[model samples]
Target: MVEQFQNHITPDSQWSTYEANVQSYRGLSMSAQSLYLAVGAILLGLGDKVPFFTVFVLAMVTTWYVFFPVIFARTAVVDFHKFNFGERFSKDGALRTAREDSKLSERAYANVLGGRRLRANVASNIDMPPGQNFRTMRQTRLKLDVFIPASMTVVWCIFAVYFAVFK
Candidate 1:
């Protein structure tokens, strides 16, 4: 199976696809954040001209209804790629010997391992449940992706309530 896979797709191509998925995840996440900010600004600017309830509903719908689903999907894709690459490239995987035989210098190999460790560190969160050992890069990204929009949504709701009660 490994030979068949290698025959059909080189490690380079698989890595490239993984990198592309990571880039797409980042682009989508940033675009969503920008959209939230833009929508909030536009609605807030309309202040007295538009009903506060309308602004609140629009903000809630845009973040939760429109963006959350897409974010979830993108996160899943990136996670899949990350896991696939790890499984294929890990020490026990078929590609491990192939990668080890490559002409990378000792320093370069060390750097590569260091980079992997750094990515792992970045993925791990203190908030994670106890006894959960492995941490993937996607987990960290998923937290940020959901947390930012959730925070924005909460702020919008607070503003809406304040306006409804006092303004």
Candidate 2:
């Protein structure tokens, strides 16, 4: 049965569709980051009303600590989405570019997953850059580490707590 299925399947050259969850989570993170920046600004403006120093400090801290990383991280992911995976694999320069981009993508995923500890897995493991070793589908975005949204969420939560409890 498996042999028959394999024989029936045609190999087509097309970019595989990304899961909706992948895009959605990235969108959500971006939105949350924007909101935090906006609201934190407003709160800071109103800081004169109560415990002036505490309020101002908390607002600034929340803006810097919480909103900043989310904005940068999510923005990078947005940049990730902008990348043409197909271009990366093209005969022109996609292979070279993709290999280099893969290292960045790998680092982003690593930071989002097991933290810096996963550096060896994503960064060092991908050091060859295709000239020395062929690029694989698993290296592109198939790995389980692709979802760094979870890590961003954790950072977001910690910042939110600081805002709620102290601000």
Candidate 3:
């Protein structure tokens, strides 16, 4: 049993490690957006003097084409997942109209009937061991909201200084 548990720690699973990495990457990607925007804005502010017309155009294109869809799609997917199927598919709802019903996994049905578990399953997959505690893990996790914006502010200030000095 000890060896079996040890194997779970290695990066070999189909879901757990992959999902954990995916979640981490998502957090990092979201955090990078503000920093990218700040850099773009600073570059735009100094574009003419720096003779960086290409960077200016690229930034403009990214702002319109790339930024909106990324943010919107991410928000929509998260919100859609949070919708309750039972409420959304009741007597007055979509499933009733369709004349077909969806089935839930036995475990999932049990979870719903029994009550939703308060603590999230952070293990990403069942093969791996469950984590310590959500509150502790959450507190320790890199909070992108606070630090990402703070770091972006410092970066923007530094870039503004450079733009002024080099101009």
Candidate 2 error regions (>4 Å): 1-50, 85-167
lDDT of 2 by residue, 1-167 (tens): 22234323232311112234445544654565566556545554565334433444454455456544544444333323344322232222223452444333322431333333332333233336565632222343332223343454455456456655766
Q: Is candidate 1 or candidate 3 better by TM-score?
A: 1
TM-score of 2: 0.30
* Model 3 misplacement above 4 A: 1-50, 85-98, 101-167
Maximum-TM-score candidate: 1
On residues 1-167, what C-alpha lDDT tens digit does candidate 1 reach at each position?
A: 22335446554465456457556765765576566556655655566526555556765676667656544544433443444534334332223345364321212112332445533443342235676654442466556666776777777776666655655
Q: Which order, best to worst by lDDT?
A: 1, 2, 3
What is the model-wide C-alpha lDDT for candidate 2? 0.40
User: Over all chains combined, what TM-score does candidate 3 have?
Assistant: 0.31
Model 3 clash pairs are: none
**Every model's TM-score:** 0.47, 0.30, 0.31
Error of 2 at 61 (Å): 0.9
RMSD (CA, Å), each prediction: 11.0, 12.7, 13.1
> Which one is best on lDDT?
1
Question: By TM-score, highest first, what's the ranking?
Answer: 1, 3, 2
- lDDT of model 2, residue 160: 54
Candidate 3 residue-wise lDDT, 1-167, digit = tens: 22234344443342354345435555655545555665557665755535343443444344335533343333322222233233233222223235545422222322322312311231121133465432212332334323543454455456556655775
